[model samples]
Target: MKNRSFALSTALVCALTLAGCGVLPGGSQKTTVDVWLMQGSVSGEFLERFTSEYEKEHPSVELEVTFQQWTGIGKKVMAALESDDAPEVIEVGNTQVARYAESDALRDLTLESVRDLGSEEWLPGLAEPGSINGSQYGIPWYAANRVVIYNKDLFAAAGITEPPKDRAEWLEISEKLDGNGRQGIYLSGQDWYTLAGFVWDEGGELAVERGGNWEGALHTEAALRGMAFYQELQSHGDGPKDADEVTPPQAEVFAKGDVGQIIAVPSAVPAIEKANPALKGKLGFFPVPGKTLEAPGAVFIGGSDLIVPEKADHRAAAVEVVTALASERWQTELALTMNYVPNKTTLAGVIEGNEGTAAMAAGAARGRATPNSPQWAAVEADNPIKPYMTAVLQGQDPARAARAASERITAALRP
Candidate 1:
């Protein structure tokens, strides 16, 4: 009798578990598409609205969106791909796109199916970074470029009349704006993005490719000159002494009316306005100053690119989403909502509705893409320029520091 009871109990438990499986009344489900994006100001409500609108047009598809912080996105993507659970669509930084493209993990969308939708309509220099070996592996959705952002009220209070038009004038203004518990300029001490701009402005190439060989150029005289110049500003109190106090949380320093000028990307404009609304009209922007007319100061171009993972189950659906994102209408909508510059040149007028967007777009037009090579990651991680910069800023000999930094960079690049 006990044996009979155990068998009955087992049958009952199996029945309960099967019943709890939970299926729709019709026993049918719509296909789900996965998308991964960075978690930030741009990913929240905007993505929800976009997905909702997209689903309405294609009733058979549902989107599952995952958000990750910018710092860990590359690792997350690689892990997802390795597990065969990769999202159909993913957002990658512009600087990182080349590395992924070379890995063969991204789908090549250069074929007629997607290209027929008008790939050439994108801005000339904007989408070039997403193209590798003549095949377009990704689409540029939004872009940001660095610009000279100044506190006009602080300048007026300091008795400065105009924005600097050249490198010498820029230094002069920085010196004049120093003292009185105010900084003449502010820059993140360890930010490669900001440092790259000054390097290019000094005629330094981050890297150069010859006959399929990549050489690190950061150890050159040009790069050292740029680093020394940056250090000089810090040593003279024209810039921040500690790199930690140069960015974001410390960005409030400007809002407190303690800094005269900074070079930052367009996304920071909204934050600046939010921190001090009264300074709205007081903020002004201009192209980064250069040493000569022929050598305009360089601005780093950083933004997101959309890629379809190789292991994704829904290639056709992914292609449709990519096409939609690259559409002029979609690009314009994204620009207006996110303050990102559209990749399409024809849609430039969409940003013209506001002065801030207009200025940002103009700056992005002349911006330069980071070097397109797999070795860039290593170069960026181990570069000695930052420490050398700190030494220069502390009043070390400029010429000597530049030479030393150059030698170190060269040694790092040796095969």
Candidate 2:
């Protein structure tokens, strides 16, 4: 909190210094729009370019940008919202919009989304979580999600000509590629995020809200079926039953070159290639298969969203800046420079030539976030889903494990 406060204070001092010198010849003060963006989301060069271009275009406005770390950001944001000098714009995780909006600290941006931003064109994974009840609070920024990264040589060896379009095909293809001292898919038993996609494909939820209260829904029939599919898929590989993907770094394991596939975000490609240079051109990707061919499997989208504080002194100016950042031009620049999926589906073409990001963009169209509860963070902090998955994979009764896990989830989700 101290570091965040210091960063804000420093930004304010710089903003005041610039404002002092920014008075127009007509004696009007330049409007300073203070913004807080996560430190690693964008590069220093990008920030500098944006600031230079924005300030030049609007001579009467000055931009004050502050970079904040993700650690303990919740408390820092809450404090800023409660203060008299909250930032005009803040960037939050796509899933965290609900928690801040719960305090009535964020401005409702539904009208802006419809009237100016083309809400219909935004990615649902980023849009759905930013919206609460019927109003939009967070503006979609960028997103990334899991995809099936497979070895091209393995597929060819297995006599597979193309990627699977549905779960049955995915399984059959994986099985075909599984023998001769190789794993078909290196799917860790406790990768609950991947399991969530399977659950969603079965029309089950991690949790459900009833009368404004959330309860874990993993014990339900639909969810159990999802879990069962996960078990069947895990049998294709020899991933550890008790640990999650990062226990020994799944990328390192996949880099050993015997694994046919792994469900991971596209960003993992660089690390995989770096670990085993032989895989540089051998890796290919596709969206995780769904139950039906109508669409790809549902994925847990992870990304950032831009929000305006309710107490900002320059609301209109803040909206203008946010609009610029989320616009097609900036979105293109951001995606290409940062290797990210743009906030809108229509912008997927910008990365069409990049195979990994292109696949990620396709999968992001069917993306979904975790249950929208501020307390959802608490649930993640002490997640029962991981252990629940391990138990099922280790031959424990899924119903019993799910019941206990759900009970814990239910308690954690409660305010």
Candidate 3:
């Protein structure tokens, strides 16, 4: 905690010195919004452009933007929230929203400057995670959801014309592709993100609350059924069963053309094209298949949220920054630049030229955020559910492993 605190102190030192009493042309103090955003979520060029555009739009304001690494951002933000020199605005992970909002570390968006933010524009599920009681503490930023990214050449070779539409189709297609010295879909042993999608589509949950207490829901009938499907897929799919799956850069891995498909976010498209240029024409995407072959399943929504600290000296300026960032033009720029799922439903159709973009937009429409429990962070950090999935894949009884994992999860959820 102290390390994170010291880091923010060092960051604030740089921010203040660089500003050094930056003021407006009329000799009035220019409100500076100290903004902290995640490193990989948006590119540097985009950030620079945003700053320039924002300053152009609001001459009385300045945005001191800083990019932070994602490794332990939650801890750093929490630590900084206690300091007198905390950033006015922050880009927080969606999962960390409940924890921060519940602790009262953030400003309620109901405040006058931000109250008309038009919450309906954001994907409802993405907004749910950041709502404390009835007011929003954080606003949805860019998002990425899992989709079936496949090598078109591999699909063609396996006599597959279209992407799988249901569980049965996926199994058949995977089996067909996994032969002649090639692998089918690459499934990770410890990837809770993808597996949880299957659970959700099959009417399962990773955790549930009852009697005002939260506990692991993996042992439920629906969850177990979902887990059984995952177990069979892992055991029979083309990947290491005893260890987490390791592959080359997504494009390079798919470039081999033998590794048929994998679950990934739409943002990988640019990197894939850069890593293996030859795959430019051979790659495609579709929403993850559901229990019913006719439709796509619920995807796990992962993204950053913009929040203003309750103690921010320039709260109005920070809220304006949030408004600008979530605007239609900026969101569209994010989609074109990073392949991110835009926060607005009106912007969804703007990304529909390719199947990859279409899949992402469709996935966003049905995205499901994880349960809103601050303790859920501790549970995720402990990684108690992964071993259960691994055990089931290694031939252990699924029910027994789930039971043990559930016990550990219940303990973690307890305050």
Among these predicted structures, which one has the highest TM-score?
2
- Alpha carbon deviation, residue 315, candidate 2 (Å): 1.3
Clashes of each: 0, 0, 0
Q: How well is each residue in 1-415 modelled by candidate 3, as lDDT tens digits?
A: 1122112333354475664455433455667688888877777778778878888888777677677898888788888787787888999988788888876878888553245656777775578787866788878887888888888888898789998888888888888888787878777777778778888887988998788788988888888988888776665455655554344344456556567887787666677778777778777898887778556787888888888998788887888888888878898998888878888767898788867877977877878888788898889878788888888888899888998999899999997
Q: List the residue pairs that clash in candidate 1.
A: none
lDDT of the candidates, in the order given = 0.69, 0.90, 0.78
Q: Per-residue alpha-carbon lDDT of model 2 for 1-415, expressed as tens digits?
A: 2123222343454466664444544567778788999989998888878888988998878777878989999999999998989999999999899999999989999999999898999998899899999999999989989999999999998889999999999999888888899999999988999999899989999999999999999999999999999999889989999999999799999999999999999889899999999999999999999898998899889999999999999999999999999999999999998889999999999998988889899889888899998789999999999999999999999999999999999999999
Return the candidate ranking by TM-score, descending.
Answer: 2, 3, 1
- Would you estimate the TM-scores of all the predictions? 0.79, 0.93, 0.89
- lDDT for 47 in candidate 1 is 71
Q: Which whole-number lDDT from 0 to 100 does residue 211 have in model 3?
A: 85
Candidate 1 global CA lDDT score: 0.69
- The C-alpha stretches of model 2 lying farther than 4 A from their native spots are 1-28
